[model samples]
Target: MSDGYSLTVELTRGGDSNNRDKMRATVEADTVDELREKVDALRDEMQEWADDFRNIQPEYRRELPDDQSQLGEVQA
Candidate 1:
């Protein structure tokens, strides 16, 4: 007979703010060492994803003229 071990891992980015990202995985192994290895791999994957996410730039909307009468004027 053999023993089985299962683990669940969750990683999150920007936890302090409203915009947040999360990653989760479940790993299983016959030994504690194997379980730890699987969890490490999952953590590495999550970290890579977080690094990539950090490189992305936020989009902003273009601002319009504040004066309503100037809206009809053409630019040179």
Candidate 2:
């Protein structure tokens, strides 16, 4: 029998505080190694998409908070 793994990924774009995207998926594999490989592949795919978006739309790229105090608050 295969084991099931649950993965949740959240990607945020733009300086807007509320703009965010979330994805959840389940992956099944017969071995731990296979599961890890599958999870890593999915993570890499999402990262690639994020990089492309950031490159294509510089205006929508995420900005770091200016001050340390701002870090305490949630940002998109």
Best of the candidates, TM-score: 1
**In lDDT terms, how accurate is model 2?**
0.64
TM-score, every prediction: 0.64, 0.45
Residue 13 lDDT (model 1)? 78
What tens digits encode model 2's per-residue C-alpha lDDT throughout 1-76? Answer: 4255544555566666554444455556667788889888888887887777656533566566676446558657
Backbone clashes in model 2: 0
Report the error of model 2 at residue 76, Å. 44
Provide the lDDT at 65 for model 2: 68
- Lowest lDDT block of 10, candidate 2: 17-26
Q: Which parts of model 1 are misplaced by more than 4 Å?
A: 1-3, 63-76
Q: List all candidate RMSDs to the true structure.
A: 4.4, 12.3
Clashing pairs in 2: none
